[model samples]
Target: MQIIVRAYEQSCAGVLVDEVTVEADVSKTGQQSTFSVALNTPDEDGDGYVAILGNGKGGTDCNDNKNQRGALMSPGNLEVCDTIDNNCNQQIDEGLDKKWYLDEDGDGVPRGPDFISRCSKPEGNYMEYPDGQQFDCRDTGADAAKMFPGNSEVCDGIDNDCNAVVDDGFPTLGETCNAECGGVRVCAADGLSVVCSQEPGRYYHPDRDGDGQGASGSLPTLKCGTEPADPGTVSNDDDCDDADPATCEGLAEVCDAIDNNCDGVVDNATPACGGTLKNVASHYVNLGGDDWKTVSVAANGSVWVAGHDGKLALRRPGAQKFESFSHYNSAPQAPTDGSPVLNNNNCGDHDWNVSWVNANGVVFLGGQTGWIGIHTGAANFTCVPGQMPTSQDAITGMIGFETGGVTTIYVGDTSGRLTRWRPSAPFAEQFTVVNNSDFAYYGLHALSPDFVLAVGNSVTGSVQKFVSYDIDSQNPVTPPTEHVANPNNISGNVRSVWMGSATSACAVGDNAAVWRWDGGTGWSKVVGPTGVTGRFSGVVMRNDTQTQLIGQCYIVGGDGTSRAKVHRLTPYGWAKPLDIQSATANVALNDLAITPTGEIWIAGEDGRVFHYPEP
Candidate 1:
């Protein structure tokens, strides 16, 4: 409610004429809550607004006391780019803010850092905010035409693509580049890139048989290109026989007369032999094969059994029976029973003793009556001409050529004569007597390419001795001198010898007298088994993986009871008889062979060939 108090003039009738009024708002509840009041007044300035007495200024004008401007700043006034509230209430140039740069070159891009905020794009390549963010470093220099990021780079070491790195995408000076076939290219001397050239030669190994093994020689086919188009050819030559695919290094040695394993050695040394004896054979019936004297396994696993009857028998590998060779002293003819045929000329009647040959598997035989022959395949044998003169000079032992391509066959005779024969030349006498006595040399061993040892007994003294000769000497070997001194005048005759190393050699003799030779200590007698009544005919040293167990002297001979006796010499001395076959009259083991597979083979009287373990 509005309450007004008026000043009344005390005049004659209290008519309340021309009175001044004062007013205020009053609450009816008397609780002093919020209240407002206004005095009714007229609109001044014709803007439909006014202020009343008893109240603060209230109007639609910034200055209510004034009448000209209505609101503090009216809407729809033109905005300007000023750092002030020019339109009045509060803000500065908000919506009118525009970033513009000076593109003095007019290339549609602007120069560095020289820009301003404007309402719109100015004339002549000037851009606003987004398009103006691009800053050009040069505006009037030689690079100005290429100032844009899309411009290609020149060799001036300047920024390209507007990125930081200089001369980045261009070829680096002196950097090397390679091609497919060993060709090389480098950044050029003139500071440009060079073409890939000067390719290397292409060498290929021929494998016409597709065996995956290359040829044997060092020769290779050279060309200039990528690999040759032939898949059968490679870059290595190692295959000995490239005409047969099954003759590679990975192929196992089959019972064929070929180097199937490509190991340079023949199939005789293959690893397929079981460790123990197997498939023992005693005799060949109905086949003119009897009393086999010497035996050898050929590259094809064919066992060549030489009989005392002057006939040769061939047992095919893995076969149970043997067949006599068709022709031993006549024209070559195929055997009827699919046996190996032979042709021999002037190989006099003699008992075969030793048989061995060179790495090429050429067969050589030595025997009684000064007889020595060479087997030239297809069942053909030719007596080596100009052999020792008399039957008393029978070749007892034979060893193949050693060192160099010398091809010297060292032979020993029962008369103690030592001879050296080159397969290409006639026999040359080496020594007529060894150890200052005529000892019947029974066995020969090559300790090294230059060193050879001959073992036998001197009939004059009835004692055994070994003679060493250096066949490689410039001068004739200082006439075979005694290497071992018989301290006790050992009465046994050494029958066989084998060398494990240049300085490590072992010799076995009558009554199992084992003698060891060390370069530093010379030869000393080591006591062997006392049970051996007969002389050891053959001995071998096993140096394969079983060296810990088998690296000893394996001596084969017989006891007086006519049973085969095999003994071994261990570190502590000779062990008891390692193997002793049942006693059979006239059954004596004459030789023993150790195969590459660690198997032991024994050949003896009565055409006996026993594989270890009887497998």
Candidate 2:
């Protein structure tokens, strides 16, 4: 028996196996049998190889023999076609001399003959192999040289080494680090790199300085040792005392120093007593050699003091102190002249009275200087334009008119004659004698421009009286037409009378007599409290509600102690008098003036001005 087989050749030698016959037909030329096996014809272009099988020697013409066959005819044709399985071993053409076609368009269809090229080629390329197998040309195929390294043709996201993932071993381009943790890979054909940022542990670092950069570690280093001190903070060594930062240089010490903690003062460092007292006289001069007796604050706030040492003192709100000189000696010779009287005894006696022209700022002073003086000063004191009287009459009381700018000075002599001096010119001429009378006008005050009230006694009867003079027309030269007697009964001489602007007045005199006049009413006696009586030496009308009567009273066995008796005027009558305490038992309150600001300045015989802030 014989069988036909195909043998693969290494090269294009085109050798074939011989056809052999079996011994079943051993008799030679027995039936003249013959057998033949055909070989395929080669192509004309010499582009193909073929396989053939033939018997080496023929024994009979095997066409007539029934049971004898020359060679078992092969099932497959011996033609060298491009179809796979040329040897027919189930896998066609898989051993050697195989060819593959690349579907460059990736359509999966190959350009080949006698085959269904419509299916996708596994390798998509026309690749040739020597194993006579047509492979898909993938990495696992026989002709897989065109595949990537490691024989892998799968698409991966990354080029593991960053070479770009054109033909890499991964299924897609290998994943890359997307600068984030545990990122995944994406398809390269999708024009994106694989994000393989699956770092085990990573964290973000904030740029504290806001420099648009991040730090590599968990905790970033600070750029400076400490933050700069804030505008007024105590850090960065800027403040001397960080604990007490407010204590710094050049700050106010208040009442502490050493900076108080550094503020730059010693102790009690701030300036002290830097402000001046308003309306207070800064310095005081000894008026009348510190023997100032009676000081009166005029209605316009000017101050005048009279002394027993024959001096008249003057002071104003801003004066350094009280200044004194004899009114007679300091009298100016002319309206424009100024003089300072240094002599203490220029006036012959200590008695004097002073009053102010409230509307005109004129000051009138009359005393035992043997003359009356009027003074005016634009800045400092200047004597008014007035000549001295030739007579030696002692002027006891003086007062300026409340209206009409009239000033009347009353001069009293031991002979019971009283004379009046009136301003005759524009304060530039000396005053002239206006009227003379036989009544002893010791204490006088002009209640108004038209009325004159004088207090004194008659020489014949020694009867104390209050006389009112009516000028009729302010004609100082004409004799007064109206006269009135003191309405109250009194047995002693009247020493003084103080007329309050509100029509209340007090008249005081010897034998502890005190009389009060309210408006146009008759005078009434002012009774004192128990154990307070002797004589009322001075009387000044305070306000409508009260009166201050200062005098000396017998304390023990006629010792003659000084006293300040205050009496309140009630609706019904005068209330009981109250005594003011004295530092010493016998201190006298000689005179009193209620200042414009309501302070009571009391003059005492001890040459002191006691100031009561408000009384």
Go through the candidates in order and give each one's C-alpha lDDT: 0.57, 0.43
TM-score of each: 0.48, 0.42
List, residue by residue over 1-615, the lDDT tens digit for candidate 1. Answer: 444433222333332222234444453556655544443333343433332223442322222233444322222334466454334345656567477777665555667576776665666677653543557656666656555555565534466446656556566534343433555544334433344454556677778666666777736777566545466687678776654454667777643224567876444543554333333543341232345556665544555556454645555556655545423444433445543334344344557787664555455777777776665434445544334543346676667654576666677887777766556644344322222237788788874546777888886877886888765444433467567554546877878887776777778777767788775335788865654566677887666444343446777774453246556675445533444333332466777766544455566775466555342
At residue 61, give the lDDT of candidate 2. Answer: 19
Per-model RMSD to reference: 21.4, 27.9
Clashes of each: 18, 54
Q: Taking the tens digit of each residue's C-alpha lDDT, what string does model 2 give over 121-206?
A: 34435443233333232333333333332333334432222233554544343345443333456545533333343433233334
Best by TM-score: 1
